[model samples]
Target chain A: MSATLAVAAAQAKTKTSNYARIYWPFVVPAGLLVFAIIIAPWVFTLIMSVHEWKVGEDPAFVGLENYIRLFNDSRFQWAILRTVYFTTLAVLFPMVLGIAAAVCFHKNFPFRGLARTIFILPMMATPVAVALVWTMMFHPQLGVLNYLLTSIGLPASEWSYNAVSVIPTLVLVETWQWTPLVMLIVLGGLASLPQDPYEAAKLDGASSWQMFRHITLPLVWPHIIVALVIRTIDALKAFDTIFVISNGGPGTASETLNIFLYQTAFAYYNMGYASAITVVFFILIMLVSLVLFSARQKTTFQ
Target chain B: MKMRGLPGKIGFALSVFALISPAILVFLWMLSLAFKNEVDNTAFPPVFIPNPPTLDNFRAVFEKNNFFHYAWNSIIVSFTATGLALLLGVPAGFGIAKSKASKAAALIMIARVTPGLSYLIPLFLIFQWLGLTGTLTPIIITHLVITVPIVVWVMIGFFEGLPAELEEAALVDGATIWQAFRFVALPLARPGVTVAMILSFIFSWNNFIFGVVLAGRTTRTLPVAVYNVLTFEQISWGPLAAAALLVTAPVLLLTLLMQKEIVAGLTAGGVKGG
Candidate 1:
């Protein structure tokens, strides 16, 4: 009996070990590729940030100079401020609009599914494509927006050309493109909500506003926070659309940190300065994410 | 909860329309503009109805531009990247899931969050060193950065949700581990695979940043090609809109057709519902 039991245990171990061994070869190459492509680049960026180099020039060590210079750079400051401004507007508008849309579409009605699909179209469309479309739409002359304004007897404005208007217009474009993503996240939250509290609220003769304020708000708070955080990070690192639409615009008026960094690195071949900007950008994103995560934890715990 | 009745129904319809009309209006305007002629496109009143609708813009896109080449490039890059991502990601996901490697997944997310350009510059250097710059190979490999994590993260949830009993049973039937996974595990994970495929395709197809930086004239994807028209043209609204629409139309159609599938794909593992 003892001998038989030992043999069975050995057989089981051999079978499980064989399975593990078979899968390891497949896992390593793919796993390494991800690590190489994704993780390695960030490390490379960090190393490159400290080294003073132009394209085709040997990188020289410039300890803390890039970092020090970043603090005093007015353009970098402006880019940071502009990024914050854009992120603030982008986050705030989308949160309000997304929540409103989610609330409106939370229940079954005619074309709710179709409405949801239409809403998400912007999210699915290429950022560059959307930027192109909006560029034409927001044209100062011969564009639909100006055309509409003039037809309605309001004076037409140069939306994209004006320095002050450029950032806001970019913000508007970002809002249009991304509000649907926030809406979708919140919609998922709303749909997953238990029906009992809502039923109880109705039984107590609560108004829709009251129910939303007291019940729905608290329940979907996590989703709201997630959407905000994700959108914040995305807005902070806003590129592609802004790049295509404005190319940092009529005299760097619409430049964000990413564009700033891109120009600093690729266009100017100032890798050290770009790297310094990137490190700062990375910190900003991490800080925002940390705050949001902590806030979410507190809300969920409560 | 019970339905609120007639007044409620009326209010709901109005609210829904109000919520969705802006997006619908924008799309409709784009569609109309795409079909309008140059004369009507910039008409003073901004013609909503293209009275003499024409396919001139699309024709212009096809005739003057290398639309077919760009489209083919996009298709090959997106599919190849997605395909490679799947081959790599599924196993990684299974391994990560089985090992419960949340840290590995978080590391992948960090990569996802970092702006593509940060890496693109250095990668460009590397590609140049390898003499592979301006090739589809670099784009496909770079796109894996976008596609792989999405596949792995999504599939992690899928693998976790799956029952282990079937695989165990296959093992009990004296099949090798590879055989069990090949014949049993993968076939059962069709939904997850589909979700991965759709998302990977969308992301890969719509990727503009990589194409812009990496692609040469001969190797340009649709977005890059469309962008070229914008820079190259003398700000001609008609052809530009036409070109933009032509580039966007296939994606738009694919999106509409796969709306249900795409939604399911995106929201999968993130949320729980059908």
Candidate 2:
């Protein structure tokens, strides 16, 4: 009896080891990749942010001087304001338009599927390609946008060429590209909603708008929140379209933090300042994400 | 109830048409530009249709620029990054799902949420130090930053959705965990794999910033090549449109072919958007 008990214990030990073998081998690569690729570099970024170094030069420890300079810099302040303004528009337009589009597409209309497919085309198309097409369209004299404006008895304005209108114009391009994403997410939520409420509301003489406001809106609020967070984060880091179209041009009009960071790092060779910008940019994104995520949790529970 | 028949249908259809026309018109304009001559493309009225659609823009794209070479580079970078991401992420996803390792999964999510520029700066310095810039190797590696999280995230959702009883039964029958995963879970996760693969490929293909910073002139991807055309060449709308269309064509084709899977993959998780 004792011998048999000992043998059983040995077998259990082997089994546990076998499980560990499979688990470790399977999970280690991903952990290692994330560490090497993401966490390590970010740590390096944090360290570099405190130093003063240009490209091809030895680093010197500066200890928050870059951050100090950033605080006092008017251009940095403008970038912060512009990023907020751009993100607000980019998120606002898409959420409103996408929810509206989703509601419209949710109905039993003809060619709804076809219309949706076309709408999402802009979303799926490469960003650089999208920017180039829009750049051509935004041309002051030769572009079709101006041509359309004149034909419609409206004035032709310098789209991205003028400093004052550049952020809005860039946001317009962003809205064109991302509205479909919001629409798709909301459509998913709409499809899965319980039909009992809508059916009961109709019987009780609620108008369609009333039903949408009372039932549909509350139900899909979580989805709208999710879309809001995603769009906000993306718009904050929007690089390709802005970089390709304006390159933070017309004398620093549309230079969001991402654009400024790129120019600082690559174009100007200011590595230390760029790293500082990266750290701040990362914190801003995290703060926004935290707020939205907490909001998501609240709505999701409700 | 008042407007319930043919008139309602017509009105609904018109509304839908008006809504989708902007989306359609953008593509149509690009198409017209690609097919029109330089004179027709730049006309103030903007020729809506090419009288005779010309392939000359495409010809110019290939001849004047090394368009084919950049396209090849893009293909290689996207394919390899996607392939490596799958190899690394699938089993990891399965392990996390089975073990309920939420911490590891969250670690990977941090990778996704952080800005790409943060990664780019340090990686750029490291690569320059290692003499690895200007090679497809660095570009492909950097793309993993985009691709791996996507694969891991999607696969986690899929693997968790899978029935656990099958793997347990396999384990109870004396099959090891690896065998169970290889034979049972992986096969069950085929649709997930397909979705992950397609989404990662589309994303890696569309990525521009990594290539912009890392690639040499000869190693440029199609998007970078298009950017060069815009910046360097005189603003010839036809060739510019043609170049843009070429960069977009492969992704556009993928979207059309596997749109259902793409949508599923996209909506599968919300960690990575844009």
Best by TM-score: 2
Model 1 C-alpha lDDT per residue in residues A196-267, reported as the tens digit of each score: 998898889998888888888889898888888878888888887888888898898999998898898778
Residue by residue across B33-149, what tens digits does model 1's lDDT show? 778888888887688888788888777778877789889999999999989999988888777665566777787677666777777877877788899976799888888888888
DockQ of 1: 0.53
Candidate 1 runs further than 4 Å off:
A1-26, A153-155, A300-302, B1-3, B269-274
lDDT of 2 by residue, A144-246 (tens): 9999999999999899999998999999999998888888888888888998997898889888778888889989898888888888888999989999888
lDDT of 2 by residue, B87-126 (tens): 9999998988877778888888777777787898899999
- Indicate the residue-level lDDT of B75 in model 1: 91
Q: Whole-model Cα lDDT per candidate?
A: 0.80, 0.87
Docking class of 2: medium
Q: Pick the candidate with the highest lDDT.
A: 2
Q: Pick the candidate with the highest DockQ.
A: 2
